[model samples]
Target chain A: MASWAPTVLASDTLIDANAVDYLIVGLYFAVVLGIGLMARRQVSDSVDFFLSGRSLPAWVTGLAFIAANLGAVEIMGMSASGAEFGLPTVHYFWVGAIPAMLFLGVVMMPFYYGSKVRSVPEFMYRRFGTGAHLVNSISFAVAQLLIAGINLYLLGTIIQALLGWPLLVALLVAAVVVLSYITLGGLSAAIYNEVLQFFVIVAALLPLTLIGLDRVGGWGGLTDKITEAAGDNPETAPAAQQLNSWPGNALSGFDSDLLSVVGIVFGLGFVLSFGYWTTNFVEVQRAMATDSISSARKTPIIGAFPKMFVPFITILPGMIAAVLVSEIADTKAGEQVAGGTGGTVTYNDSLLYLMRDLLPNGLLGVAIAGLLAAFMAGMAANISAFNTVFSYDLWQRYAVKDRDDDYYLKIGRLATVGATVIAVGTAYLATNFSNIMDYLQTLFGFFNAPLFATFILGMFWKRMTATAGWVGLVSGTLSAVAVAFLSEDAFGSLSLGVIPVGGQGAAFLAAGAAFVVDIVLSVVVSLVTRPKPVEELKGLVYSETPREDLVDADEASYPWYRRTLPLAGVALAMVVVLNVLF
Target chain B: MPTAPARATQRRHRAGALDIRNIIGGLLAAYGVILTLMGLLGDPETDKTGGVNANLWAGLAMLVVGLVFVAWAVLRPTYVPDGGAEDPSAD
Candidate 1:
């Protein structure tokens, strides 16, 4: 087994910071602390701390909804992917993200917000039973810890490489900052900072892209340079189809047979996307913080608009790095350049290289601040989500039943600290994985894909019994594990006659298979068992629920075209245009 | 009649309505001003991106937008609902 180690940078390669850079970074930290302190006064009870008292507006919740997902891994991994895979990587944003976000806003929000469930696991308890709730709560808690650790690990590694600070020191500073704010102000502070971080990320990335584009000439210039570089080194040439978003022949476009159009559509676009964006509590918590049902329903739609354009800043820089950072024969053993020949390109260091090579001192600080903001936002999001599930779903339900609001609130704060500590420990474990993002997606397949299956059956099919919910969830998760173990690539154990899709593609397929099994088992078991009465299933199930129960009165006043559907239409149109253009 | 405890609770609720937009706007404006100043007055000889000082331009733009958000927050303060939890099943 590979041991955990931090990615280090040579002292000479570190960007020299000036007075202005330090000032910018200092100001950024001060503002974040100020926001946290300000939000501290708002938490008077458990609801206030855990759910922001459900008082945010559409725009605030909307931006934060997307921001929570924009972590260190996202910034670094997506850029690395852009350099490695080219335009095809944009699928993670567009097809893999947009539709699902829209679905959450339009279809699923009514159930979550209308029912007024404090968290996703609470909803599982109401719809399924204690068994399903426990399964989800435990799984979600574990996933959040792992994800938090991954964010911390990536942040520490990046900061160490950029500032030449000890990895442990960097991790400590991040944990202290994140823990202080989250413990003091709770989810409100986390959400407020996430919105702020969104703007900072844009500010940091857009400039690098513009400057790089100017130097390269234009988009055409970037492509030409890449083509030239690939031409010189026949061994490193990207597939002919990599440059285009969607080639005329799907099979010919991808470097591997694993990236089939069918897999991208069914596996990634439907199962993984819906499972994550719709059911995952980390994203849904933002939407649930909205003041009214209408705002809650609009939150993900609002997020989707900005989310559609994020690739320009996030992915474009990597593409530029691919062209500009040339292959150099480095004498140092520890130093790995972005696009080096013979020596491996430290693909994870792509974003750091862009900031160091492109920006001046003052601008460099803003960029570094932006990177810090993303890391903090990501860590805080997981901690908040973890605490909520631990306190409300697990502790309240199992350990300390019938506790007062104050008791629960106290537990929530303590849980935040405890989760943060565990997460810090998990961060050390992250170094074992080769690619953090791929590992994260595989974990999602194990838990969320099956969870979404149960959710779909519960919400849409009223006949789904509580027994079926537990059985489906367990069976679906098992099927996913089976597929992973059976796949020749993932475990290299057994054959299921399934063609070898690469890591990401295989994960997507496993999720798809799990979804199918969940739906089938749920339907069969539910039919055989007794079903709940229509009255009992009122707000929980769609068929029996009244239209007014699902929608806000204010939203009903608007015409059909004036609502979120138009936004979805516009987003879909843009996706089509991008696919064609690329 | 409204009791002393009820009035105190209302006061706490009112105080809790800290407009998050105000915080966002203030922080952006602060950072924007600093970056803008550096872009305008900092070392000109070390022209990294040829001649265009992106820090100054982006900073000014962010400053204007942040100020607009601040102005909006002041002009139309967000209303705080009563301090109470809803019946989860009421809908």
Candidate 2:
């Protein structure tokens, strides 16, 4: 037996997913529900329920934001990508997703909050007026449903693979557990559970990676094994290209070129960053729920450091697993077992295969919890966003403004249950595609990108009329979506051949086209379009600083380095370095 | 009673049409444009028979679009938001 040292594991763990495992998972559920019940009392109004009375500190939102967004799909998808591509695939999350956030927090956040809108759909209201807000609200809610569907399916699939349970039952149960807390508490419950879930998920995974390493024979052994296998037939194995510096599929040339690297930087850095940060109600709600200006700015920025570390703790194992594929198929005592390629049976199938064969029972249980935490956190986050848009954007417009807090919170609960049903359905239906979760995230980018443009032009370009905002949003989104359906086949694996381009390429192309169109149409149309009144613009920029808080405002004034330009320079420098180093 | 202060304010206003953002945007647009342009310029690298011909067509189309953005941002009138109009903090 491989010695269980340097980290934690035991021989029995491979078969040990038992009642205790279920108990711990159940205990976690109870705690989340309890917190929801307690926090429910604090929310007495729609504003309080939806916005936490704008009182949550930045850290709460930050932790929750990362935790929720990190859910089962991200965990499963990244590991899937990691197992398939080896160590380099981390670029999608670390190099691509992380830098995009830094670009967003400094570049996009300032512009987004420059106007005092609460909900993202509300921003559409100010920029496009109420009619367009209705359109955006529906689209935004549907987009949230799309994301939640992916999370639900991923969670169900993980549970079924681990437990041998029915997928339909698993999906329904998963939805109920998440919706219970979200319905009871709203954002507060989701955030509270998230901060806790973050700890639980990490607590399990990091130890597993470390322990799995020694058993697999440390870093040196992993290297030797891979080399020995690949070396046996040097001609058969793919050579490391670009030192794995610019991550790309070994299958495609578009992945290897410096142009792809540039695409990763800009597609992630500008367009997707702006789009997700500004438009995605799921991640953005965390920033919006901050109680004060400092709180709003602080949460997203704090996530930066933690965000950088995840690929190592999560994706790195899958990389090593790629090296051990041929070995896993056979034992020290026995002959070959099942199919294997590049150490993975299938990109999506491999990680579970490793867990079932490689890990001990107790560690299996803990890993199972980590998966649960990821599932719960991710689903809860998406549902929270979905429920918010459904309740705030869609429901409230129909409901009277004067309705009691209880009724609205009740409606929110009802919406949570509805969203849960949709999510469960999504989970079941997700079987339609081979790797649908990864595909969903990239596709969501198409819809969200135009919303980012509206926020930007509204804030900085003062003459950008509300009418212009509507026209730009509609034109940009329709054209982008049209381009999406049109261009998918042409782009294939690495096709930048068509105008719209492929997934990452299209994200930027759509957003860039949207931004350019947004600017031009907004400007040209606004010349004929009516201008926003000065009084409205005043409220939009600076919240009337109460005299009592003058000291706070003065104290909170950020240092020079944190200013947008200088900080952007640092952000850019880091992006360049990451591209070079990775 | 609040009046404009004499302390220096950061230059929040951007004058150039292209900065950190558009550079990223421009690259994507250019990637599209280049594929299209290469087809038209008859460059071997981007040539895709029909694909290059299509990209060439797209490149000209996006070039027109890009030029529209270039013209709009540079020539479009700027407005000072309310505080921006009067508050020195905005200045």
Candidate 3:
């Protein structure tokens, strides 16, 4: 979309490099390596290597969770959004992410950590049967791989932007450095690094704010001047609007509301919140090897708190940049706002400018280190998770002999390397994706959406059979993927049946279709299909299990649905109130 | 019931979830607010070089001072820091 003008505005260029930058960044990296090396001693077995043997204190896991999820997109996207958009765009974090995560922590997490299952698909196998697990494992793994690749790609691009390094070399170095650490240290190393990243990342942002405030007109002045400049000018108002919001003018005519917003929030949130976090292989692996239910359960909730704030770190800056565009251009805010974006200006670049122009030396590097930490943590977490799942679930399931730790660990490392290569390669092809959020959301919707319905039914409804689980999973995934690619022209409209729709409409339609189809087929098949032997059902039923049991036997002690009724009522009220208010 | 990390690890596999001590939500809320306010209010340079605009010299100075308030509010560093789960075995 950009010609690049073959020119680097010194502002867009790497404006400064000094000892202060290196010192903070160097210290942050050293601490991570030190922690990684330290954690290596802890990684003697699969459980310890992958899940920290379920012993992580809540705070470390919490910060690590944030660090893992916080990637290049958050670093650039949030700031870029804040700098470009104004106030309302904060909804991306607050309105969309926060409430959902809170709901997950308060209501949903208890169910997950209580479940005591290692992965999402493992729960499906437990609840439904192996068939559903088989279908979803591949799709879900691919989706995670896509996330890993996209993140790897963003890291490489950021490297290129920061140092003018060749893209592939940067990608490989980052991937290898991180992979080596994770291979040696596993989840403990990842979390330890994440803990360090959390502090350094914040340290970086704090200074950027100071310099930007000091060097510019200060916070209030920046707002008043921009408001004054934009108030009188119609041409500047829209750009001001984009710079201040998520539905940016950068890509012209891109507007969305509840249908879109709900679709996105619940789509990304419920799927990952329930599917990946609760039942999936990668996220839940942390819970699996936890020493006890409290750490397993509490660690994730602790993690959720930071998850809610992460969007704040990056989204606001972009919104602010959008508001201050005219000031940056030495023109009336209106003039800069007038042209209105047509996908020409990459929003990611705007964030980098704010970082270059706004942040001071030491903090900038630390913030950059935060970006590096996120990339490393996310990839490391993904690799650790995927390799374990592949080795334990797939490889071991099919392999002839019981393999040695070295032999299996080697396989896991190879899986990590293979996945990393695929991911870096995938980044080059993300031109089709408009932005990181879009790419992340779209894939999550297609792959994870199916697991949600299947998992819910599998967990609660004892009648659900393996056949039904398989059918439900297949329907959910296939339908979501099919729907993602659909357009108005692809499906003819009907005034009596439906109106013309686009983007996520298809994804929802697919999910709905799958949900209904799964329900019907599961009922029919559960009745006709063979059921698990009664003794095997003992796990789902109570038989001397701990509280973290995914299916509690003492249904009467706390009839979950009955206890959850009040919470659901409150949730419905909030949604209705928000629906009205928004 | 002692609420120490040692007690926490002793019963890590016990009956309840990891309690966040009721303060995390507010911490997150404050974090969101500071970021939003800064984004809305920030405008350091009117010129490309990021020099303080003459008219806003006083306001800009106060804004820098105001950051002290933001720091005071946000950097309080989450009371009940680890939700009382500071166990060596849990690490």
Sorted by DockQ (best first), the order is: 1, 3, 2
| Model 3 lDDT tens row, A141-216 | 7767777787777777666666666777878888877777777677666666655556546545544554455544
Each prediction's TM-score against the native?
A: 0.90, 0.73, 0.72
Kindly list the per-residue Cα lDDT of model 1 for residues A10-69, writing each as its tens digit: 432255677787777777787677667767766777777889878788899999999999
The runs of at least 3 residues in candidate 3 whose Cα sits more than 4 Å from the true structure, single-residue gaps closed, are A1-6, A9-15, A78-117, A209-277, A325-344, A488-521, A539-582, B1-91
Per-candidate RMSD, Å:
6.0, 18.8, 9.5
Question: DockQ for each candidate?
Answer: 0.24, 0.01, 0.05
lDDT of 1 at A292: 87
Best model per lDDT: 1
Per-residue C-alpha lDDT of model 2 across residues B1-91, encoded as one tens digit per residue = 0000000011124421112112212322433354354445543221112122333443455456544544553465233232211211110
User: For each prediction, how big is the interface RMSD?
Assistant: 9.6, 23.6, 11.8
lDDT of all the models against the reference? 0.76, 0.57, 0.52
Q: Rank order by TM-score, top first?
A: 1, 2, 3
Give the per-residue Cα lDDT of candidate 1 at A484.
75
